[model samples]
Target: MVLDSLGKSLRGVLQKIARGSTVDEALLAEVVRDIQRALLQADVNVQLSLDLTKRVRTRATTEKPPAGASLRDFLIRIIYEEIRGILGKERPFDLKPKRILLAGLFGQGKTTTAGKLARYFQKKGVRVGLVAADVHRPAAVDQLEQLALKVGCEFYSNRAERRAEVIVQEALAHFPAHLAVIVDTAGRSGIDPDLIAELKRVRAVLQPDETLLVLDAAMGQTAGRSAQAFHEAVGLTGVILTKMDGSAKGGGALSAVSASGAPILFLGTGEHIDEFERFEPTRFVSRLLGMGDIQTLLERFDELSDKESAEKAAQNLMSGRFTLRDMRSQLASLGEMGPMSKLMSLFPGIGAAKVDQKTLDATQQRLRRFRSIMDSMTGEELDNPHVIKADRVHRIARGSGQKPQEVRGLLKHYESTKKAAHGLVSNRRLRRQLEKQFGNAEAPAD
Candidate 1:
């Protein structure tokens, strides 16, 4: 709001000038000065911050305002574009795991990153193997060795010598049988002449498919210098900015990207290797510039459930044509919403924080019983559950392995959710976001 108010003030100033009133250069300079202060204070690089203000000043003076575009509108648009150009394209995490070479400062997370990337590929069904080439620093080998267990990948290490080249030769020979291989190399604080020379030797030996620089985003603007030094030393093909979730100065990673001219490939959001998110440039900039991540949510939903069936069921329910068959269809859809506790967590104010596991377990057991009881209905009986009187309930209980009381409870839960889904189908905007995330999941992506 404070920034928006400043934007409004500049808008008013430009509005006056576009209307043909004479404006002194002094006033225009003052406007650019205020804008510069706003951006720089937001943690933009001092030089880039200065260049942005200069571009706005030059354009405001040189170009005739487009018919009625307020000076503020013209200037804001220019600043937005220049900042984007500086931020550049989001580098994708596209390394297909033939072989990746990781290098970083000691304790800057290279081995852990290699393990995480390997495990990520493994989840995607790519066979993965790791070579812990970082032989210096006590148990850099053992540390990666222990961490490799949680990842379910093979880790190769040679403790006999600190020479990284010999490890690379062994890794290259072994990794070919696997779809992916991630190599971890030793790191030293500040550029160690010895370390870079050793990394270059390993790089020569393996000629890795990709070389990723692991940077700690926690270092703020200093990340830029660190990225530059690493790039000059061993050539950076891509960058992984770690620990952004804990940094408010997350924008500093942008500065590092701008400086090193390497695309950002992955973001380490949390401690676990699986906590990485593949960086998407457009969506990322959209979020940074205050647009929400609605598209990502849509993709996640589409990946989870069947779009066509969910839409049809929603349409049928809204037209007052709901049936017991529809309830069965919905059970399939609800299953797409993930485990019952996960479904509950999607409720506002619940996701991210942990929930009580005992309650979740009991609720899930009830769903299983509900599904079993529903299965006991005859085809025609399932289409219209009104036929399920006390006698039907007793028979279903006997057949489905649940008591009559449990059967009745499921009927009540079904009725409540049917009503809620009924109301939701009427709102087109809400329906779209819901459809993306809440339908049938395709047979788990092979």
Candidate 2:
């Protein structure tokens, strides 16, 4: 789900109608054409895609399937086998009390990813600490502090306007026992000597076990230049592509991995501290081929979804007690789980068509605005959006650092949620439908 449209054009043509030994040439040609289109649209290297297509085509015609195997099965099998071979094997990060330096463009979400990577390792029972080494004009230190809290990891920052290298030095001085340290650095608007020097300064002393180049998936080919610049300066061990939740063509993600000659280690899917997914070559290739990936869904749920909280949310909805406050809480939970699209895809048949591309993009924009407005509110106001009268809206808009219109939009979102909450309560069929769609194990049988 990182690049929602990456595999959108992929059409796996199932031409073999019945379970028959005989295969036709025209159908084979059509299926191969469809495969090529899908791979290209997925931002897969064109030559790689062409070569793969050739293999699949040649094998489809020349190699005969065993007696009982359907042509569909034969084709799927061949495609999977070839890709698995191409993807090769993966070597995960295995560092102990090791340092990992995160480098990327200013708005590429490097600081946030540093925190997420810490959380990922923390899950494995590793001690993790972060240094707010991003000493630039941006509020990078503050961002790291906030995300560090969300991950329950320690944060170190003098915020003394110290240079990036100095901050890393201080972090090393106070480095916790047996901990993984993530040193985040400020980024520039473009690839330049100054930016590279700042990162090189940090890289020179730390000599980290892994240096990840953070990039935005939406950056398109621009990501290529940034990756190349960083690699030339400090040599990236891997890459982390952020904002995978957006409608990025996935082209930039592909470009960074292929061109940078660095393995993709992690992906940032949302705004939350815990919103990340590790790279899995097999699953990714499967997705590129329009093959469903249920494993990713389950793994994400394990990391993000709290069963107890979900049960409580369900009971609240059934009892007609869900409010704007509940909506906010639920959204926070969803953010913790990676991309919104990925979460929606888990809802039975919703995966196939829950939200179209346009609506999904708009919803993400609206949600960001909504969250900003909510942040501006006091605890009481969040519980009672109705209390946000005109004057109060203006005050909150200023306090939250958002526009007055955004406050109103937040109210509208609350109104919509309130209506849906009550619907789940009064309508028995609606309750059943909701249960069937998102019910927890303990949900009442309405």
Candidate 3:
């Protein structure tokens, strides 16, 4: 859902290609123009946008598709490749035992990103230690210390020391056993000599393995200049673009930073510590083009729920044994998946761009209301909805502080879901197929 508007525009352009009778020069030109408009609207660098479309145009016109491929598919591939070219190729971020230093200007979410990085590495099975090297900010040390405690990582700071270099030196010795030590450095309002000198001193003491610039996605064209300046001041190995979920100009920042010769190692999708993600150009463009990133979706599920519980939930739904409790658990899992818009973007042909924001908002609200209503239900009513008579419904409505009609709506939904699940359970062939899939057995033949 990052750059949701741009995704809608791009998907609209692709829809044009799909609906066209034939792929020709005129049609290709129109598609290219639409792409340019979308990029420009998303605040992409003008020259970069032009160059990308040029490449798209050249490839679509000159290149021939393979024998089995359709012209439309080939053209789409060209556009995907060109767009990805501007974003750079994917490279693996090293996760070995090393120290990472975060640097950037003020108000780029550096401290928050430090927490995210700590969570990231901790999840990767690395013993992480957070170093508070930002001595200038009044609460920077406290902030990093709290983040360290929240992330369950070792924390190190010398509050009395004014020089950041000294703190880095002490932290390095304090957490030597930690596989990944993340040093949160100070930032200035703008790139200045004092800031650069301070970074140099910290780097001298830290001698980090990776120096990452915590760039803000809203920086747009200025993101490139900032990255270049930082790289000039102190060599930058990679960049982490923060606030990606909320930035309409995220495309601009991503393209600009990639153009500046710094590989984007990660993305801060949201404010939560777990919302950070590694940046992969192919998967990102795939999702942007409404092709869904199945790999990431699977990873998300794996991270949130174990296989046993997931299989049990799936089996319950398939067997028409779903209860209000099961429904509530499923709803909670859905909420854990982040915003509905971002979650929808993970599905092919159903990206957030295809659905209006108002509709999504309404759906989310309904889900919350349903959950609240269910919370007011007793265990007996939750396990067996048939016992929930009109009187029980009124009681639940009053308990949940919702209207009687809303309680009836939840009941209606439950009945609809129960009916649908029964239909699936009654289908012998489909049930067999599902069992085969879930049991890891050989596929059931037609």
Candidate 4:
């Protein structure tokens, strides 16, 4: 859900395309105008936004759908490609032994992004070391130290020495055995002489393999100037855009940074340590267009859950034996994945369906209450939900601090879900229909 406002607007445009009867000039013109407006309102560069819409229009008019592909799908594909083209392609990271330096201006979430980067590398099974080289800022050392502890990575800082270069030089020697070292360097209000001089000295001492500028997505079009300034300062290898989830103007930063030739390496999607994700242009655009990103969804599941537990859940679901405990487990897994709206955005055609935020929030709250109610249930009741009578329901509600009617609602929901799951598993014709609907029955045409 990065750039929520822009995403909603774009999704609305795509929904119009989906609901249209034909792809005529009028429809095409309306679609292009809507897209251009969405991009411009998101603070995208004016010329870039106009050029993108022009390309989309040109391609839509000239291109033909592949065999068995609908004109709607072809148009959707064209928009996806043009928007993705501005974001730039992802470069595969060479994750060997190397040092990385983080640089940015003051108040851009540079320190927090350093922690997120540490966690990202830690998940990749790299032994990371975090250095607190931001000597000018008060408590910056303590902040990075706490982050290193939270991520369970090595930490080093010379609180006694104020020189950033001296601190990083000592940090390199401190982390000799570690494969990946990430240095959290200093920042200033702007690209001043002193800041550049300090970063240059630190760079000379560290000579990091990757020098990334931590930028705020809310900076909008100004992000390009900032990126160019930093890139010239110490030769930034890439950029890390932070606060993407909270910013409505992220599209401006994204397209502008790409124009500056500093590819975005990662995105800080949310405020949590686990919310960071590597930037993939096609997958990102696919999500934006409501095409779904099943790969990322599957990867998130794998990262958050146990492999054996996932396999067991799949088996139970397919065998029509899904239990209340299994449902609770799956719900918990979804909670860990992120907000209900964000999760919904990953499903094919769901984004354009315009799932209401109020409804998603209500559903999320109800799930939490259901989980709480389930926690008060006995193992016997979880395995066999039918055993719980009125008396037991009252007792369970009292135990969980929920109303009796709420308890009954949970049971009702459980029964309905279980029944539908059984239908999907046992009804062969229904399964075949679903297979076709989900595009699993045949190979898709290019």
Query: Model 3, 1-446: lDDT tens per residue?
Result: 67799988887787778667899999999999999999999999899899889988987877787544568756766676677678865667877778899999888999999999989888888889888888888698888888898999888988898988898888778776756888998989999999999998888888888999998898887898999999988999999999999888998998989988988989999988898988987667767876444346556765655645555665788877877777777778888789988888665335534668899999999998998899999999989988999999899999999999999999888778767765544443442332333222122222
Model 2, C-alpha of 168: deviation from truth (Å): 0.8
Candidate 2 deviant stretches above 4 angstroms? 4-11, 14-22, 45-48, 62-71, 81-89, 287-446
Query: In candidate 1, which residue pairs clash?
Result: 301-436, 301-437, 304-441, 305-439, 305-440, 305-441, 306-440
RMSD of each: 15.7, 20.4, 14.2, 13.1
Q: How many backbone clashes does candidate 4 have?
A: 0
The 0-to-1 C-alpha lDDT of every candidate, in the order given, reads 0.67, 0.69, 0.82, 0.81
Give one clash count per candidate, in the order shown. 7, 0, 0, 0
Q: Which candidate would rank higher by lDDT, 2 or 3?
A: 3
**TM-score for each prediction?**
0.56, 0.59, 0.66, 0.66
**Mind sharing the TM-score for model 4?**
0.66
- Model 3, runs deviating above 4 Å: 293-446
* Cα error of candidate 2 at position 290, Å: 6.8
Q: List, residue by residue over 192-284, the lDDT tens digit for candidate 1.
A: 899888888988987887889898877767888888888888898888888776665556565656667877777787788787776655445
Query: Which 10 consecutive positions of candidate 3 have the poorest summed lDDT?
Result: 437-446
Looking at model 2, residue 136 earns an lDDT score of: 72
lDDT of 2: 0.69
Model 1 residue 346 lDDT score: 43
